[model samples]
Target chain A: MLKRYLLSPGPTPVPEKVLLDMAMPMIHHRTSEFSNIFKEVREGLKPIFGTRQDVLILAGSGTAAMEAAVVNTLNEGDKVLVVNAGKFGKRWVEIATTYGLDVITIDIEWGRSVKPDQVESKLIAHPEIKAVLVQASETSTTAYHPIEEIGKIVSLRDETLLIVDGITSVGVYETKMDEWGIDILITGSQKAFMLPPGLALIALSEKAWKFTEKSRIPKFYLNLKKERKSQLENTTSWTPAVSLIIGLKSVLEIMNKEGLPNVYKRHALCAEATRKGLMAMGFELLAKDIPSNSATGIVLPEGFDGGKFVKLMREKAGLTFAGGQDHLKGKILRVSHLGYHDFFDTIIALSSLEIGFSQFGLKVELGAGVKVAEEIFKNHLGV
Target chain B: MLKRYLLSPGPTPVPEKVLLDMAMPMIHHRTSEFSNIFKEVREGLKPIFGTRQDVLILAGSGTAAMEAAVVNTLNEGDKVLVVNAGKFGKRWVEIATTYGLDVITIDIEWGRSVKPDQVESKLIAHPEIKAVLVQASETSTTAYHPIEEIGKIVSLRDETLLIVDGITSVGVYETKMDEWGIDILITGSQKAFMLPPGLALIALSEKAWKFTEKSRIPKFYLNLKKERKSQLENTTSWTPAVSLIIGLKSVLEIMNKEGLPNVYKRHALCAEATRKGLMAMGFELLAKDIPSNSATGIVLPEGFDGGKFVKLMREKAGLTFAGGQDHLKGKILRVSHLGYHDFFDTIIALSSLEIGFSQFGLKVELGAGVKVAEEIFKNHLGV
Candidate 1:
């Protein structure tokens, strides 16, 4: 039987060590041992989030944290600017509007980054805007938004909190929340944490914390203030996903041992290899100039269904690649090299893609993509 | 060093097989393999929940599912009869009120079960009440509400939907969702499922589905309609906690092999043995006559601090027990004999508790509790 591989952008491959760590016998969350582990995880996440403030852990996906950030910080009818460049970017608008916020969307084209000027103009035009929401890396379209520039502008403005969805970027990219003036940074365990999805991690700056104080939008389970108060004593406000927290601690330990710089470099190397390999296989990139290091979106050749291609890769080659979402479906295939993936995984993915495309009646050179990926790996590894 | 044990009501000790199952390599959610596993899980949950309706899974705690049940079935200004028997019961009211629902509380004492007559009277008095919310087993006070009676009453009324929080009781107690006329039965992975606390599982009946048509509450992530649409195809509306789902699948498999009837019997036997042992040790039961088979709530002996006693059991005996929440704090210690626990675990817990209580200056005969627990286990096991 062929070995199955998960190459999806969000639920990336978990490290063997993290899996082993999670396999340990469950510990009581109320006990000191669990508290000690939680303390280490909370402190460990601080440097990774690039913030000194408390990081809130929720037993939900990244979307829950996003909802929490909105409900806890923005009041009903509060004006907010949402930078919509992709599916995830649009989700911010959807959630904000659902919470009865006055949402002003800065509509950037799909597969393109949110320009700093567009964000600045939106903020300038709407002085009543209490918050600006954007995605650091839009997983749906593989677009890396200009978060630092957006954060800087929002930071200079009074009362406008900069909320960033760092789901696909936190561990793979440099998301310096405090340094970049991002008021709220949200990520999940699945993406770059090298763990299976269960926990949503979020860090809020003083500015965002202040916004939470007067926010009237009602919330219960995802209340940031209650979570923060409990987390101060190294405990979750409610029952946490204990096994996932253990997995997170193990992944953070690995990340700490490798160092953030090395982790970022590794992701960049994988992204470079995947892009080079796909380009060598005569594939056109969807997000051309500002592609995300988290995932590489490839436009299928004319007459080839990207969704069918993804299915073929999974069924024939045992490679599970992500198909595009919304409008991008059947047009592009997303190849993720984030989290526990490395050069070898990239080679396998490219090889699988080669087989899939060829089998699907699209002409593609066999081993051409793998060879390019190998060359890139060799260059990076100095072999 | 002695191995640690979890005695918390939720986030119970995960079965080793469940952890191992979750540790398996991640699979893409959209793939056939995942869909197959998800389908099996959904089917398995039906027997456990005793519901024929579709069971939707969400990546959050039990509260998320509770929120989903409310937001999906109740509209703004909807009158909901909330039976506040414990912390979780009050939570239903809190969440409903947060969503702008007019909530009428059937306030029962913390350690007492909600009376069926109280619910019936409230519903009769408030003809506008559209929903009746209560917990099957309130984890906070270890009281099992009379859900069957409440269900029967709610079923008699055409417009009032019965929503039961089966989080701590689903797998531990005998829950017949369809037979008992429970419109919406909600549970969490951590409690009776014997997995981590990330996945919230909810099953809705035709009545609940009809109520959803008129629900006007704003919801995104916890929207049951969206979840049902995706779940019919064995997929989630959003990113799922893949590992937790895998763990849940394994747990359900274990439950299937053991059989749900046998699982419930085992939990009942364990709870009986634990309660008998604590009683033999001269400890008073906090929940009194009507108690949850999920956990045994024991009142600390006079002058004994519940927190310190729990700490001693955890630190010195390497046994972790749950201290009571809120009003019961420092007054009661809860010993959970819920999912994944057995006869031997009960014996160990009783022995540890006896030793811890004696060490903390409580008057207790050495080995007395253990003897009682052993006798009960022996009788149940036919040894």
Candidate 2:
């Protein structure tokens, strides 16, 4: 058997403990044992989301929660402003449009964060916009938008709500959902939760709750009001993914034991080390301005196939990095340091990248990248 | 640690092999190895669904697929007929009504199968009906509807589509999608597939495809057309619950090895033994006519509390059985025979029930229920 490492942004490496937790025997969803676990999980998610609001759990991928946010707040033909910077940002616009919302999008260049000025201009021009949707961190392009600035702009209007896609940013970076006036924050269990992708978590502010009450959109299984009612009693509106919930409960305990500040600091140190290592190897970073701290996207050298490079790393080195999507398919490679990662793992990733580049006919110095990464690790760890 | 057995209809006893398979290292969703496994899974599901059509897999519970079926076929204000017999049947009606569809429900008594006459009468009375939805096996009440007869009636109208919820009945009982002329069939991985819940599988016939082309309902994450387009090349429209997919692939391989007929026979034998055991213990069955082979619903004796009986079974005998839902709560106990159960398992379950009844202060003979179950198993196994 080959040793494999997951370096994707969203479905980052899961902790060994989480896997063992999932292997436990399945429990009945209606049992009191499950309700106790569910109650703890709900209370645990509040601080991570940076809010005092109740967070609802759904048994689906991140997109399911994203859809829940849209359907629960917007009615047919309701005006909304979407900031499109990368694949995920554009996905918000697509989903909103699919639900018959009148979407006005502010297009930013791919691999670049959405400018606060641009978002402000869009919202000012469309005063009828009921909501402003943006991604805190776009995983596809590795761009992190300025949520605080967007939140400031949206808070000026009493009727406007700000929705944030925190799927890839929740556990990696700082997200003050309540303090920043973010009305709806959506995330998933796969990315920074260090678990498999079966659970989605969403927290809604009072403003968003009011919008939900007035929204006339048709929904059933993902109905937010009904789900919230059940959550108040520490239950789900429907039969939940019970095994995944157990896994999530275990991961939540681990997160609480390690405190949020230390977890955030560890991810920041790993991200900085990875970036410094790539720079030492003469690789250019994509999203030079306002790059995401969760994942670092590097541009492949001229005439080097990014897809083939990822394949080589996966097959030969057992390191699975993500290739760029759509237009960036053969142009960039994304290396993630989101969850359950450390200094040693960063060193291994740099060594694997060096070998992969060499195999792809790009000249690279052996152990050069690792040396830079180790220095950063030493400085961060003060060892 | 106490040795426990899961007798719930879903989240049933997962095979040890499937659990071990899911514990393997995670794979990148975009890699060729993962795509190869996904392709094999798609091919494997066709025979299980008994359809030449493609089956779309979503990373959600069974209700998500139920929502997908309704949102993709019926437009707002469209007339639809929902045959309600049990909790799941009523759920379909609720889902339809939530989507702004004009739902005409044929409500049947709980624990009884939906009659073909009611379906025909409703259709004849309402020629404007565009779709008819029903459950093949209501897991809540343990009743199996007359799908073959309903299919015959619905096939007469070229415009109206017949949708069947086969979540708990697909692999446990005979469900020949193409042979029965079922326009749409939906199932989940947790039930008879012997895997944990996360993945929902749905297949569509030509009539359902035509309905989708004109459906005006709002959808994005559960959009079947987009899923079908991506699935043509053996890919998902979005990030899938990859670990569950791996577990499902392994479980399907095991099913193929055992053969579908053998799996069905095993479920039938277990169900028969359970029924005999319950009868010998002098307990009345909730589902009087057309009881499902997937599970047996036993009505408690006079002055008996269903919840307390279930708790006694769980704590003392280390057995977990599903209690009644909604109106049936405290009236019946549901014993599931679906998914990876055997004759020995049936015997153990009966013994546990005998212990539970004795603890509840009911007079019952020791080993009598087990003896009856063993005899039934012997007759079925021809030993």
Candidate 3:
């Protein structure tokens, strides 16, 4: 029997405790029992987001929260700046344009992060820009954008809001939303929360909340204003994803037990090990300059077939790694060091890569990658 | 220790087997394993919706699907007809108006169903009416609209679509979407699907699909056209609620094993028994003319505190029931017979109602309601 391993960036392995907690009998959302849990989960989310504001839990994917951030904070025809660095960053452009926002984009090359100067320059050039939409970690390219720096640049403009899609970066690294001057921050449950997909957690600063008052974009389900009012009373404007919220409460308890700082350290060490292992296996890294701690993208060789390699790794080794998307398809393989992942998972991934590469007729020594990953993990102990 | 029971509409009790299935190890969404389950679920949902069309699965609550129906089908400022009978019907009007639809509503009494002649008259008066939005079962008042007659009327109009919110009706009764010529139908997992809230299943007919082609509403998260294309390929446009989808597969399997007709019959029997029990206990039902098979709403006695009564039922009797919303608050109590419920659950509800009523200084016989419910179940056995 081939035991499967889920190593994708999102839909990460769920902890048994969280799963069992969610598996318990369903509770009515309007009851005190549910409200109590909702209250705890909301408060628990603030620390992860590093925000003093209420972290509104939406019953949709990260994209839903992203849309809410756009429509609720900006009016039609309002000028917006988007940093289109990768697939998710491109989504910001798409969402902004869909809402009739005049989108000015800084299109960086794939596998590269946008510089703070570029955003500052765009803001200066377009003084009417109301919001700067960007991703903290572009999942598609595994590139880490300097959100803190960009937030600093955007916060200086009283009319501009810094909206960060921290779907892959929030709990994986230090995402100080308030300290970084981020106006709006968003993340999904399937990412660093170590839960299955569905729920999206978002927090908006006082200035961003003010934007909702004048925002003219028509909305019903993803209405952040209604959500905020209900959530403050320990309820939701709509029926929330009850099971996921229950799971989120348990996950927060787990995070608290592990300590948030240690969780970040663990993810950092795992990402470092995975990177070192890939380099030792004679692979080119995609985001070498500012790689995200959530996942790592590796450039495939000229003749390598990424689809076949990923399929073989799944079918033969029972390892699941995310293949590249769009232009990067058949060119890279992304291995995640996201939530519920450890150093051993990185070892297994590197081992599978080495074996799969050799099977694909590449000159790769067995255990070379695993050996290097083991060393990095060993050195991290500081013994 | 109190043994809790959930009998609220829309977060109805989840079966043990389905919960256990969802508690299994998480799987990556882009994998073949997940695709196979998604494909099966998509097909399974069609039978429940009673449609030959592809039923799109979304990772949000029922309101999200309701919003999708409006945004994907009608453009901004388009005229639409809403049958405002209860809370859910009001939701259709709210959603339609929120998306800039010029809403003309036929207001019905809180617990009364809307007449088909009124809808036909509205359609006849305003041929420009783009759609008729109504609820198959209005949970707030336990009212069921005549969707079949409304569908027949709307089907005759080439330009008008009939959108039915079947959140508490689809799996509880015979909806027959295609047979009734419904343009768009929507339901949530928490209600009759016997799953936790998160996933919303929506299906559209050819006419509604045509409406999407000319629609100009700005949307990103609830984009039906994008979701339809991806769902046809056994995937979702965005990350789905993975664990909930897994549970839905198990739920479909259970429903199929029981047979759809049998499932509908079971819900009908339970609803009938609940109504009889409440009546025998001297409680006046809110919807006496045309009641919903999903839940039953009973008007509270004069000078009785509904909030206190509901709390006592929960804390003292280990039973949870829903109180009315808005103007109906403190005047009604809604007990659900939807999803994963049996005749015994109705009996339990009736028993609690009798005890709670007697304790509240109302002249209620201890076993009056339970005796009636038990008799109904016994007679149904044909012994």
Candidate 4:
């Protein structure tokens, strides 16, 4: 029997402890018992979010929270700047346009992060732009954009807000929201939280609250103001995905044990190992400059189909990796080391890649990547 | 340790098997293994929905599916009739109105269901009503509408479609979607599904598919055509709530073992016992004519606080019941006998109500209601 291994960018493996905790008897969300747990989980999210503000939980995916951020903070005719670098980055543009926003899309080339100067120029060109929407870590390209620099640039504008989709970034890297002047930060449960998708976590600063007060967009299920009011009372505005939040509490407890610095460092090590492993196999990364410490995107070698390679890995080796989305489709494969992953998982991922490449009739030595991953683990013992 | 029990109308207790299955391990949604499982789950949902049509799985709550039904089935500014009986029914009006539907509300009183003849009369008067939005079971009042008769009336009109909020109904009662000519039927993973709230299951008929083709409402995340196409390929369009769908498969398997008729019988027995138990304690039901067979709503006795009674049940005894919403708040307590509950649970719920009332100085006879529940169980067993 082939052992199954998941290396997808979003649904990274869940820890057994968290899983078992979620498996216990379900508790009603309105109870004092659940309210206390919700309170603890919210309080614990502060360091991971790097914010003093409330990190509210939603019952839907990160996309829902993305919609919530837009519709709750902007009016119908307001102008907004979207940094479109990858599939997720393009989502912001779509959501903005759907809400009748006058969108000024700063389309960053696929697989490339936007330079802070590019965004500043666009904002200067369109002073009416109310918010600058971007991805902290573009999942489609495994590119970590310089959100810190963008935050600094956007903060210079009195009326502009910086909204970051940190779906795969938070808990994997540093996103000091309060200090960086980031107005809205969003994340999903399936990434660094080591839980399944269903819960979207978003935190808003006092500056963002100011935007909500004047926003004229219509919203019901995704009104962050309503959700925030409910969250302050240690509850959700509506009936939440109760089991997922229980799992979230368990995951946050585990994150608390590791601490923020160590948690980010662990992700950095795993991602570094995976990237080095793929590069040692003579494979190029899809990211143009800097790579994310959450997932590694490897460009398919000549004559290799990214989709076929990923499918073959899953079918033959029981290894699951994510293929590219949108413009990058059939050209890149993304392997995540975000949560419940270690240096050893990088080795297994590399080994599967090596075996998969050889099976596809490409002349490459098997274990070359695995050896690199092993050495990185040995060298980073202290880290 | 007191025995903890969840008797809330929405987040009814999760069956251990389903919870454990969800907690087992995380699987990547793109993998063939997961796709195969998704296909099986989709096919299995037909019998549960009482339809031969495809049942689509969504990653959000029932409200999302309700929104999907509205935004996908009708164009903006299309005239629609909403049956506003309780909180959830009013949700349809809110969603339809938010999406720019010209809403005509058929207002049902707080604790009553809509009459089919009245709906027919309204339809005859306003043939321009393109859709009728409603709930199969109004959770706020525990009132079950005559969905079968309403469906029959709406089906006679070529231009009109019936959209149902079966959130707390489908698995609790047999929703014969195909036979009753239901255009759109929706339900959630919680309630009678024996799982937590995260996934929403919706089925659409052929006429509803026709509506989606010409609908002009904007939708990105809740796009059914995209979701349906992906499901046919044995996957989801977006990153679905993978763990919850896995749990749904497990619950469906258990339901299959019990058979739909038997499952309905179980819910009927539990709900009947709950109603009789409360009635025996001289408690009045909120529903005027017919109460939902899923949850029983008991009106507050003279000088009794519904909130205090429920709170005392949770704190003193480990029992959880649902209080009212909107205008009915602090006036009614909903005792649910949905899935994952049995006759013994009905006894516990009544005992808690009795004990909670006595402890709150309401002067109710303890064990009087539980005695009726015990008798119901014994007589049903043919003992």
Q: Give lDDT per model, in order.
A: 0.86, 0.87, 0.91, 0.87
Docking class of 4: medium
Q: Name the best candidate (by TM-score).
A: 3
Candidate numbers, best DockQ first, in rank order: 3, 1, 2, 4
* lDDT, residue A187, candidate 4: 95
- Residue range B1-383, candidate 2, lDDT tens digits: 88999897877888888887887766778788888989999999988888999989888989999999999988989999998888998899889888888998998888888889999999999999999999999999998899988999998898899999999889987677887889999999888998888899999998899999999888888999999998888888878888889988998989989889989989888888888888899888888788888999998876789888787677666789988899888889999988888888888888888877886788888788999888777766745
Scanning candidate 4 chain A in windows of ten residues, the lowest lDDT window is A301-310
What is the lDDT, from 0 to 100, of the residue A84 in candidate 4?
Answer: 89
Model 1 chain B: ten consecutive residues of lowest lDDT = B374-383
Which is the leading candidate under DockQ? Answer: 3
Model 1 interface DockQ:
0.73
Give lDDT tens digits, candidate 1, residues A1-383.
Answer: 98788888978888888888889888778777788999999999998899999888899988899999999998889999998889998899999989899998988778888778888888778889899998999998888988888877889976899999999999988778999999999999888998888789999999889888998877788889989999999998778888889888898889989888988988898898899889998988888558999999988766677777778777877788898888888888998978888878888888888887887777799999898878778867745
Compose the digit string of candidate 1's lDDT tens values, residues B304-348.
788887887778767788888888888898988888888888888
Candidate 3 global TM-score: 0.98
Docking model 3 quality class: high
Q: Write the per-residue lDDT of candidate 2 for residues A1-383, one digit (tens) a residue.
A: 77988887867777778787777777777777889999988998888999999999998889989999999998989999988888888899899988889999988888788878988888778889999999998898888899998898898888899999999899887778999999999999888888878888999999999999899888887899999999999999877887778888888888888888988988888888888899899888888678888888999887888888788788877888989988889899998888877778888888988887887788899888999888877867655
Q: Rank by TM-score, highest first.
A: 3, 2, 1, 4
User: Model 2, residue B198: displacement in angstroms?
Assistant: 1.3
Predicted model with the maximum lDDT: 3
TM-score of chain B of each: 0.98, 0.98, 0.98, 0.98
Better of 2 and 3 by TM-score: 3
lDDT of 4 at B119: 93
lDDT of 4 at A340: 87
Candidates 2 and 3 compared by lDDT, better number: 3
Question: Per-residue CA lDDT of candidate 4, range B1-383, in tens?
Answer: 98889898878888888888998879988777788889889999998888988899988888888888988889878999999999988888888888788999889898888999989988988899999998998989999999999999999988999998898889888779989989999998888898888888899999999999998776777879988998888888778899998998898899999888988988888888888889889888898877998899989976678887778788878888899888888888999888898878888888877877887777789899998888778967645
